[model samples]
Target: MESTLQIMPVQRTSRNFGEYAEEAVIIEEPIIKQKRPLFIEANTIEASLEHLRNDCIIPVFAKDNEATLSHVAFIEVVQDAT
Candidate 1:
């Protein structure tokens, strides 16, 4: 069966600077759709992750059925920001 994945905003930032400290600042914005990861649908989280890795797509996280494959949807992504 085919499925559809939802796309969301992924925030990113960059440092902007000119000739002086007055112009130095951090610019934050949502990542561009063109540069964002492509949505992929799969029956299982494992399969989805495998496909992402195989395609060299780095996902911040994704939604999938429960670990028991009970068809209960949930967010399944981990972030460890130091």
Candidate 2:
């Protein structure tokens, strides 16, 4: 006597949770504008010092609204003096 085995395919189903359904709703928040420190670059020491001068505006190169890393020097301005 010969015996044959039968195979069956299983179906997948997604489980729903109450917490996941609550998290699906997104709440929009108001955006607040804040002042951020900007770093400037210069070639020489004199040029770097020039950038540190108050009320001095320097040209900066950026791509896609972001600063690039190819600058020659970097300067950070401190608001509070100790």
Candidate 3:
């Protein structure tokens, strides 16, 4: 089965530091939806990112399934800033 991937633009609001510090707000704008496979053969994060760069989709999990998959329903992508 094919999975739908939604690409959205993330906007970060300015932060205010004062007596009451306000947290930055994040806004997501829907850009486009692309069809991709739910699973793929990727050994590392680089491999998964490669798939995302070339195929425009991130694999939810590796096909090998070597480790325990998360029970969370939502998918989160975390990247290092450094």
Candidate 4:
């Protein structure tokens, strides 16, 4: 008898959860804006495309280490868009 195995993919949620609201004047008007920070990572460009869709982040800056493995970290700018 033979058995079959099924492989599943990872589901990602929205990592961005930071925003900024502002009011210029008291009796004039109000303004609101949101800051969106994003980080995209993967082994190859093909896989990175999938990460972009899942994480909503574009690979702006990148660094390839020849002696270390890749990793991720959260920032204090707008959100943990990674």
RMSD of 3: 29.4
lDDT of 4: 0.47
lDDT agreement with native, every candidate: 0.47, 0.52, 0.52, 0.47
lDDT comparing candidate 1 with the true structure? 0.47
Error of 4 at 82 (Å): 71
Task: Point out where model 3 deviates above 4 Å.
Answer: 19-82
Q: What's the true lDDT of residue 5 in model 2?
A: 94
Highest lDDT, which number? 3
Shift in Å, residue 62, candidate 3: 62
After superposition, which runs of candidate 2 have C-alpha atoms over 4 Å from their true positions?
1-6, 11-24, 41-82
TM per model?
0.18, 0.25, 0.19, 0.17
lDDT of 3 at 9: 97
RMSD of each: 29.2, 15.7, 29.4, 29.0
lDDT of 3 at 59: 40
TM-score of model 1 (CA atoms): 0.18
**Candidate order, TM-score descending:** 2, 3, 1, 4
lDDT of 4 by residue, 7-81 (tens): 999898886545554555658566777565444443335445345446654334346433322222222222455
Clashing pairs in 2: 41-73
lDDT string, candidate 3, 1-82, tens digits: 9999999999999876575967889999998988754564333244353454466533454787454433221223322322
The C-alpha stretches of model 1 lying farther than 4 A from their native spots are 19-82
Candidate 3 lDDT for residue 36: 58
Question: In model 4, how many backbone clashes occur?
Answer: 0
